[model samples]
Target: MSTTRHYINLTNSLFPLPGYAADGYARIKGISALVTTFGVGELSAINAIAGAYSEYVPVVHIVGTPSTLSQADGMLLHHTLGNGDFNVFSNMFRHVSCVVSMLNDPHEAATLIDNAIRECYVKSRPVYLTLPIDMVQQKVEGERLRTPIDLSFPLNEQEKENYVVDVVLKYLHVAKNPVIVVDACAIRHRVLDEVHQLAETSGSPTFVTPMGKGAVNETLPNYGGVYAGDGSRASVRDRVESSDLVLSIGSIKSDFNTAGFTYRISQLSTIDFHSTYVRVKYSEYPSVRMNGVLRKIIARMGRLNIGAGFKPNNTLPAVEPESSAQTITHAWFWPRMSQWLRPKDIVITETGTANFGIWETLFPADVTAISQVLWGSIGYATGACQGAALAAKELGINRTILFTGDGSFQLTAQELSTMIRHELKPIVFVICNDGYTIERYIHGMDAAYNDIQIWKYKDLVAVFGGVEDKTARTFQVRSKTEVEALFSDKEFSAAPFLQLVELYMPKEDAPLALKLTAEANTRNNAKA
Candidate 1:
C-alpha cells in the first residue's frame, strides 16, 4: 500500500463512493483504505463498505475512536450515537464486515491487524478496525510483520488439477463454436493475460461485459463486440447466442451486467471458471483454482490446435460514418469519438447516457474504460475519474479522459477540486443536454421534474480552482464541425494539463439500447 495520502477528504464523509473506490481498486489490483472518524464517520462509510462486501472487493476501513481515558470514563463524544456505549458502532460494522477489531491492548494489536488484513485479501471483502488515540503509537513485535500473508488456495488432493483439466480439455477438443465471455471478476482476479492467451489459443471470438470492458485488447482479430443480450448490437447478439459453447471466465451475472437476465446461453454447453472453482456442464469441481488451470491451458495451447472452433466475423467497422449532418446524435458521436481515442488513454464514463453511449465506442488498443455498471450509481464517474487519474499519474501515464453527462457531473463535481489539488491533469468531456435525459427516456419523456438549471460549464473550472492556460482550460462546442475541429486541434488534443469541454446537443439524444433497457427495467419495477 502506498502511504502517501488519499486524494480528497469529504466534509460529510457521506459521499457516494463504494463503487468509485472499488473502481480504482479493480484497476490497481490492490486493497483500498478508507479512513474516517469514530462513530459518525464509520456509520457514514458503512453502507459503501457493505456494498464492497456484497461485490467481493477488498476494502480496509480505519476509524479513529475516542481516547482510552474517555472510553474508560464513558464520556459522550460529539460524533457518537448520543449514548454511553461506543461498542454500538463496532457491533453494527460486524454484520457487514468480514473482520472487525478494536486496538485497545498493545499485546494483541499486531495479531488483530495482521489477521484483519489477511482475511480481507483471502476473501476479497471489507474489514473494519477502530484505532483509539491512545493506542496509535504502541510498540509491537516487528518480527511478526516479516511473515508473509498466505493467499494461495492449495488443493489437498493432488489429483484435483489433473482431473479438472482433462475434463475441460476434452470438451474443448469437441466444441465447434467456443466463445469466451470475460466478466468483471476477471479484472479483480488479475487473469487478463490468461484471458488474452486463452482467446488467441482457442481461435474463438471474445466478448466483454460492461464491467469488464477494456479488460481485453478490443482490437484483437477475433474480438467481438459487447454482449449484453437484448442490449447488445444486432450482430453481437446473434453471433454470441449462436455459439455452441460458451466459456465464462470469472463470471458475475448481476441484473444490470446481464441486461436484466436476458442472456440466453444454455448451462448444458457452458463452462464456468471462477476464482476457486470450475463448472463443466452441470458438474462442478470444488476448490479447483483458475490461477493454476489458466497456466496449464496456456502452456498446452500449441498442442491443443484449438483453432477448430467457429471463425468470428469482424462486424464493427473501424470507422462507421465519415460524415455527419452537423448534428451530434449518439450514432454519429460514438463512432466519431472512437476515431478520437488514443492508445494508453484511461477513459471513465458516467452512468446513464455516457455509459450507454460508451458501449457503442471501439476503444483503441491499451486503453482502459472505467464504469460503475452493476452499482448503477450516478455521480460515481467524477470521483472514479479522480482515483483512476491518480493511479495513472502514479504509473507515469498521462491522458486520462472522461465522458459524462451534465446531470451526473453536477452530483459530484466537487471532486474536481481534489484533482486540481493534486496537480493531476485529465480531460473531461461534459455532455450538456438540458436535463436528465436518461431518466426522461425511462419514465417521463418530458416531465418538468427532469429539468435542471443550465450552468456556464466553460467557466466552472475558475470556481473549482483551475487557472486557465496555466493549469486548466475549458471549451464550448455546439455543433459536430466545432467539436471535430476542437479535437483535431493540436493544443486541445495534446491535453497538456487539465481541460474540460462542454458538448451541447439535443436533449433527447440517447443511444437506442439504453432506451430499450430502461423500458424493460421500468416494466420489471412496475411488476413488483
Candidate 2:
C-alpha cells in the first residue's frame, strides 16, 4: 500500500501523465504532493495550503516555467513579471521555505525531484523544484518515473557536534543576563519543547517575536510577550537593551517588524542559529546539522548551575493624554474591552489601527493572540482569524473575536464565505471609518484617495451564505453605550454569529505610535 499521493497538472490538450488517471489521485493518504506551474495560480494555491497546514503536513512543490529561450528574450510573461522578474518568486518565499531550485535538463529531473521531496520531509518546510514547460514531456533515460523518495534525518559526525557545543557553551558562560529570542522558525521547526526546556534551564526570560506570538504559551511564568517596534512592552524593551547576551533562535531582523532596526542590542558575543549556518557576531561557524546542535545545547544547558531569575514586572509607561477623537474612542474602547475579556476567550486583531491600540491597552494576563506577520500584508488577519478560529474549535473552545479595520477587512472579504462554509463562528468588529485610516495617518494625507466605497455591514453576511437574521448578525455602534449593549446581550454571543460593529472613528484620532509613523512617512516623502 502506497502512502504518498501525487497530483499532476498537465493540460488536457498537452500530454497527461502516462498510465495515470487524474481522478481520485488527489485522495491519497499519508504524504501527498502537488506539481504545477508559476503562471497557473499554483503558487497562490500552494501558499494557501502551506498557511492552512503549516505545522502538520509538508508539501513538495514542482513548478513549471517558460524555457530559457523565453528567459533570454525577456518576453512579457504572466505571473513571472512581478517583483524584479521571475527570480523574485523564489526570493519572496525564501523566508517561508528551506530550499527552492529551477531544473532545466531532462536528465536531472528524477534526481532533483527526489532530493526536493526528501528535503521537504526532513526540514518540514515546503520545498520547490521549478521545471521548464518544455521539459515536462521530454524523453528521459535511466530511472523509472515513479521512484520513491526517502524521508529520513541523516546522522551528524562527532566532530560537528563538538564544534557547535563549544561555541554555544562559550557564549553561555560570557554573558550574565542572556535572553533567548524565538521566532516563527521555532514553531515551524517543532522546537517549542526544546525552547521551553532551554529557557527554564537558563532561568532567562523568553521573548517571542510577533510571528512567533504563541511560541511559549503566555501562561508560562518565564514567557515575556512580543518584543518589537514601539508596540513592545516597556519592561521587554528595558530587558533587551540591558541584557549582556542575546541568543536568537531562528530569528531574523526584518525592517518593518523590528521598527527599522530600533533595537540597540549589540551583536557582540551574540549567537545566531540560522537556517544555513551557525553565526556568532561577524564570524561564521562551520555547517553543523541543526537538530544535533539543538539537542547538544539543550543537554549542556540542563547541566549548568542556573537558577530561575525571570520575574514579571508588568509596570507600563504612564499614558500620555492626546486630544484627538480617535485617541478618545480607542482609550474608552480598549479599557472596556480589556475588562470584558475572560482568560479563555481568544482575540485575534488585524494589523492596522487595531494592532497599534491593542498593544497599548492592558488585557487580562495572557488572554489575546495577535498574528503579527513579518511580511505585513494587509489581508493576513482575515485568513489568520479563520485559521485561529478553526484551531479554537479543535480545542473545543467557543467565543472567538476578530477586530479588523474596514480597509484591511476588504482585502479578504471573500473569506467570510469560507467562515460560513466551515460553520466556524467568530464575532467580527469592523472599525468602519470609510477609509484606510492607517495610510492616511502614515502619509499625513487628508486626501480623497484614502477613502473607499462604503457598504452596509449587515448586508454582506446575507450575500455570503449566512443564515438570514438568525445565524449571522450585524450591529453598527457609534457610541460606547451601544458597544456595551451589544456584548452584554446573550443573543449576540451565541454560536456561529457575525456582528459588524460600526464605530465612528475620526480621521484625526491617531495613536501615539501612529503619530510617530506619520511623521516618519512625511519626512521620507519630503526627501523623495
By TM-score, the best candidate is 1
Q: Which candidate number would show the highest lDDT if scored against the true structure? A: 1
Regions more than 4 Å wrong, model 2? 1-118, 121-156, 229-231, 289-291, 302-348, 357-372, 384-401, 479-504, 510-528
**True-structure lDDT of candidate 2:** 0.61
Write down the RMSD of candidate 2 (Cα, Å): 8.0
What would the per-residue lDDT of candidate 2 be over residues 369-469, giving only the tens digit for each residue?
Answer: 54544444565666656655555665576767777788877767766776777787778888877778878876536778787788776678889988766
Which 10-residue window of candidate 1 scores lowest in summed lDDT?
Answer: 2-11
Residue-pair clashes per prediction, in order, are 0, 1
User: lDDT, candidate 2, residue 207?
Assistant: 81
lDDT of each: 0.77, 0.61
The TM-score obtained by model 1 is 0.90
TM-scores, all candidates, are 0.90, 0.69
Candidate 1 — what's its lDDT? Answer: 0.77
Per-residue CA lDDT of model 1 for 1-528, tens digit only, reads 333323323333656453365445445545667777887767766766666665666777788889888988889778876777888999998987899999899899988987887677766777888889899998988886566655544543558887787788888777777788898778766678889888777668889887788888878877887888788887778777887778888888876677766788999989998887989999999888786787776676454323332333333344434554677777667766877889998989887788887777888788888777776667777877877777777777878898888988888788788778888889998999987898898889889988888878768789978999999989988888897798799888888888999988799988867876787777778885
